[model samples]
Target chain A: MALNTQPNLFEPGKRYFRAFSPGDDFYEALIETHRDLSDEQSEMVNARLILLLANHIGDIAVLREAMSIARAGVVAKD
Target chain B: MLSTYQYPKFEYVRPPEIAEGRDGHYPVVIVGAGPVGLCTAIDLARQGRQVLLLDNDDTVSIGSRGVCYAKRTLEVLDRLGCGEEMVQKGVSWNVGRTFFREDEVFNFNLCPEPDHHRPGMINLQQYYLEDYLVQRARKLPNLEMRFRNNVIAVTPGEKQASLRVETPDGAYTLTTDWLVVADGARSPIRTMLGLDIEGKVFMDRFLIADVVMKADFPTERWFWFDPPFHPNQSVLLHRQADNVFRIDFQLGWQADPEQEKKPENVIPRIQAMIGDDREFELEWVSVYTFQCRRMNRFNHGRVLFVGDSAHQVSPFGARGANSGIQDADNLVWKLALVMDGKAPATLLDTYGDERGFAADENIMNSTRSTDFITPKSRTSRTFRNAVLGLAEHHPFARALVNSGRLSVPSFLVDSRLNTADDAVFAGNMVPGAPMDDAPIESVGGEPWLLQVLGDRFQLLHYVADAADLDAASVAALQSLAEGPIPVEPIVVAARGRAPAGLRTLIDAKGRIRERYDLQPGTTYLARPDQHVAARWRALDPARVRAAVARATCNA
Candidate 1:
């Protein structure tokens, strides 16, 4: 199965806050993955998390797209 | 420290060669009377070949080193005539629990199935093991043990290898057709011969403390990663025989080794892990940094390296001594056949090939376990902790946790000596795999399958009826038994009378048939080391002979 590049995560709105925000739950979950880690440790955790998610989404084309999109705005310092 | 056990010093006797002012020659000369060397000497002497074993020291190992013995190693020891004694005097454990912080993440049972002869693993001090092997070696008149006779020089030649030895009384020279270097990890013989081991040496350090205490801790392997008692570090707790416990603490690379080994420093750490109220005395303390490495080739001309001299692995898994015992097991039969001229000298090369493969496997697993226990980089530790945290609740994450993948025998699936299968078979007892154990009934009461199937090539033929053992099958078995390398045939009958003049074992509960995945006419060819060489659906004399020839490197 390929990675779903579209907005895939969602949560039902509560009574006071009724609104639709796609992928917000995923962003929060990703932040929680790095909860108590230090700066270096957080980066390491993210790298491992990327590998874990990549293995789960085991399509070469989807991984290539994901890698390209993730590095789109990053500039080489050297 | 030496309260419960007293070290036995073997008497050093003057060599006859030195007294007669002449050189001594032997069929096999094994250096270093450690576990591997003694085991090899015993095996060779049992085959009626004269063996000389030399050691620099007259005593067993100084400390309680190498405390765990795996089941496969136990089986080899059984063949060497000391497995029962070792098991009787050792602590047997099959459960291992891994803890993350204060919670138990997961626990595993090493042997979930029953009806086996030995347990999954046993924890016996190295001194006892060596002592047992030394005692067994003394019983063989063909084998001579020369303690305090150190080999100062080794010269390997095409036909033979010569050694210059220095005994307590004087010096002498000895030569042998084959030289086995089982000295140790820091092998002086290997250094003298200009050989090098190639691999990585881990930068982490560990402090091993063997403590004597009469406590009620269950006989199980307990490992901790970042526990409250020892935060940010790892600890391993194992129960050995004689009310002793082995505790290994991972003190990072930068810690002072000398300071960590002090009683004042080690005692408090043990107190922290096992509570302050428990009274315990330190029996032995050591600081070690492990390396997972091996020589490029185990066989170099006439000189062969076994045990730590051939390969070394981290102590995270108990692979060091266990794998070395297997190295001796794999090499002895081939060496015996070569010495007797029944097989060519090239047959010994398969020992190097097979054992070299096993060494790499052990080194790989030991390195992985070390990496998991002592993560090198911050990122690696982060991922490790993440896995541990998730493992507390998630079953998938538990599979990722590696608290020392314990040692198991390697499956020589790619061994060149094995003949490929010609028929479909169930289970993992394929060609090149070690034969699994099951219960059976014989005239001598009940014995495990492995207890009866070693020290030579064996043919386990299954039969269900008298018609199954037709004249052709009997002729095939008889002919195979008279071949160059005889194959001892043992019939496993499901429900039938014992065949006349044939060794038959009754499958009491059919567990043997189920474990071996045997049909009515199934036949399995096992090597002298008990690894499967080939299997067939029916008895074919020519095929069995060819497979035996291939297994012995006669092909």
Candidate 2:
């Protein structure tokens, strides 16, 4: 069980604008995961990447909270 | 090997009067005899207006331009007398399949409901559309077509406009009560007027190749993003009439258009995409860069701009020529009424107001599709790919993936011409929306709703049984029959009954009641373009007269 200890809780899957830094390392690492792989393999890497990140968080409540927030802005408002 | 499609040359005849330097004045002179201009001329001539059409060239369009014609456009074409020919010869399609890379991500059937007059769309060459319109135009004796007569200058005046033309014989000057500018995107008349049309020019290019091949591919629209054959770019394919397939390939802004259009360069790319097993001959090739733009107004004093001359958008959604035909339909009836002094000139102003709104909508949708297909930023590309990736599994994500939001009819919900509805309506037959087609049985034969409402202001008075609508109400409705621009009243009865005198049509399958959501004694006032001007739950003769007045801009 994960304890909500911090003053501010960081949601797991919510869309956080500009989450990445100016450094190119994160992008390069993301691209490197599928380097020279077939399209099927590349998609599998994407799926695996999602599972790995979800497992690292390991909080059902935070994932649910994040999902509702992510679904809020799919369409643009006039 | 398939043979290339041959182009037919229309003979250019020089009228003796023009050669003898005789000046002629016309009620309406339409510039450019393309689909829009030709259709406008036909519609105007059908309304008893003397129309003259001028075009610089003596042939139909050279390439297979604007292959997709939407249903709304087909209805407008039907009123002009050649919709049957177009539907018979064109490839009617209602299914579209979209693919992301090697996987089919989304597929849609535009016409889910049955019993409509025309299919959702038909793919035919632009030249064929123009040829049919020309053939139809020739039958209308009131319409005089002057091919190979190019307009050099246009001078707009208060009462009329004077045009300077250059023909094979000599230059001539003619005056017209109204000048319709349909000379295409690069309109010389628009240039002469110096009306600045402002909008964004996308930094993307596309190569269109028309190929003649006998392949057994199903007649449906197919689009691909990051196709296997053309690795990173997008591709669109549609089957046209006569075994001709129209293929469009997205070439980035940096591509050398001239070099890429060469047969040697195009053949290899096409071979890779369609495979070398099926022998194909290239018919036409052209490169285009799209721009989303429109003039400040469609109506310019005595001069009116229609079709490509008035507005332009990316060819992704098949909006270019389809919307142009609708523009002609919107303008012709109003122009005719105004020319006959039946309606005020302000009625013509509504053409600009309504069509400009439609142009903005087409631009917005096309721009979004263009951005998704050819994303400019890394962020945009990432988001587009994510949507495409999820669309493979989730149905919700499929809605977000827009290869092209294939052109649908514009709902003029905000038109000033429509009378405000006092009662709640259930279906799409709201004021300013196109009338839904319903199967009906008449004395002549079984015809759709559109077959009866032919190019006139129609008052569809729906009744439950024969003993409906009091005598006072009937007299008030019949009074509308005598006017400068007459209103045609047709009584619609429920499945079995028929009223004797008012041209009653039987709603055979009860589809009319279900689609219209009408109770007993409901009335719907439809405009000449078959769009609802107003509707009511109960009959109100004063209100119906006011609604008719509003539609003509007389109220």
Candidate 3:
């Protein structure tokens, strides 16, 4: 099966890591989403982003799944 | 005549030493045979998972590290089924008094909480408490407590953890499904993981003197702030259950640490707390700096941090070890469920969220307590004395008395903060929640919940039928269990019909009040670790489904 075609896994990366990262196109979109969250909520999201990224880098198995989730999520959006 | 309470003999069948490849692997390997690590192993083993417990110490216990255990920690131990022995051997004292100078004294009674199951505090030497935990850990069939083995390093991954152990026999590598670091505050595993601990390192050091003294001290804790005998110093005198006493003196930054064991200096400091009028012998005297700090993140890959590794508060509240134990209690079941394919991944995140919040709260409390008693400047010292002075005459100081005396009440990790409401019970700890005393009969001795009004750890049997839950929500709860809960985060089942299907858990007295807090006619799904996963007004099928889903998915 294609990487993104796995079952039960949700689409990933609809959310950005921070307020603005260099060369990121979703800065405006994330800013709009930021309006929905309080300061604590935004910080919670940031913390979750760090953990998810750590999971991807820490373990190969997690990285494969994360890649799949990212591919499938972006594919679905496109 | 023999001392009836003798330590048991260990003569177990030894396994042949085999090479690493052929042996079937364990899911997690815990280093340190301390109470926190041992109990964490037991909690996992009870869930039918395999664990390898490693400790560098040849035998159990090192020193009397933490003695003042709060009610919340006792409740967690009770869930682990060791509370009976803990309570029997330990001392329970609930009143705390602050002595200003020599004359003015104010006391705060920590006993009168609204709950009936537990009072505020218990006292046992740290060694005795860890001894009971090590005994319980040894009994688990899936648990292997490897003594004299120290954790050299930990490498965390998505599905498993790699550990290096330095043993007298030799060095060995271990692999497991998860890594839980319970090694003390200077945790080697934590440092390797690069977890940042952020907080002010208080320059204020203290003298912790555990001595056997005969004096006129009350059966409570007494603190002296800026007293004449030791002018511009702080004194913490706790009367432990027996003749033993814990005396801590706030030392200035310039004080020499070597003075504690100098033989010339130890006795004079001991005489300061208990006056020279009495005879006493010093057991252990250590002068150290009490730094207040906590890690920015509690998890590094498959590794989960609990107890001191995750956070360390000042000894002011006796909260550091107790809160870390709560972290262990909260994380184990969720990890078990996910590892066992019972719950979702989001549940693991709640471990960090809930526990980090707890550590943050405890840090705030410990810092406040430290500031109030051990002021930094002349003006701050005057303010602290003023507040403590009013404790007797004013109602506000009385409230300050409860601040450090009580623990942070246990509540669900994701539960929204309760805004001010007249009829609401406000705390992370919910009311009439299912407790850890799962009756012996259910799930073959695994931890289960006894509903406030329901029978012991009984499953929902059939909510209109056995599989009434919708697909979307069922999947959510299954994936996000923060810890071990009876309802399976999906559907905690029972052996029998239950007739009414849902029943209440009755205490020894058979009355229905929440051990933490109480609310009538409420159905709460308690985490296997015994914090409420989610709660509702009625046992409405849809609401139950929604709550389970909310708990599981963060929806």
As for DockQ, the candidate ahead, 1 or 2, is 1
Deviation in Å, model 2, residue B272 alpha carbon: 1.6
Stretches of candidate 2 exceeding 4 Å from the true structure: A1-78, B1-4, B466-473, B496-500
> Which 10-residue window of candidate 1 chain A scores lowest in summed lDDT?
A14-23
- Best candidate per lDDT, number? 1
Going through the candidates in order, the fraction of native interface contacts each one reproduces equals 0.03, 0.00, 0.00
lDDT of all the models against the reference? 0.85, 0.83, 0.60
TM-score of chain A of 3: 0.37
Ranking by TM-score: 1, 2, 3
- C-alpha lDDT of candidate 1 relative to the true structure: 0.85
**How would you encode candidate 3's per-residue C-alpha lDDT over B1-555 as one tens digit per residue?**
111123333332222232443333567877766777877888888767788877666654444568788776777776677877888777677777666667555666665544334556777767778778877886888898776667787777777887777666556677787878888888888878777887878877777777776677766767677677678777777765456677778888888888655646867877765677798766667777777888887876688888887788888788877887887777886687667665676778777887787787678667766665665544444445545555555444444432243464444433431111223444333422324333313323322333221211221212222234445534444444333333443232222222222232222221222332334333455444554545543344445444545555434
Candidate 3's error at B248, in angstroms? 0.9
- Select the stronger candidate by lDDT from 1 and 3: 1
Provide the lDDT at B14 for model 1.
93
Against the true structure, what is each candidate's TM-score? Answer: 0.89, 0.88, 0.72
User: Where is model 1 more than 4 Å wrong at Cα?
Assistant: A1-78, B466-468
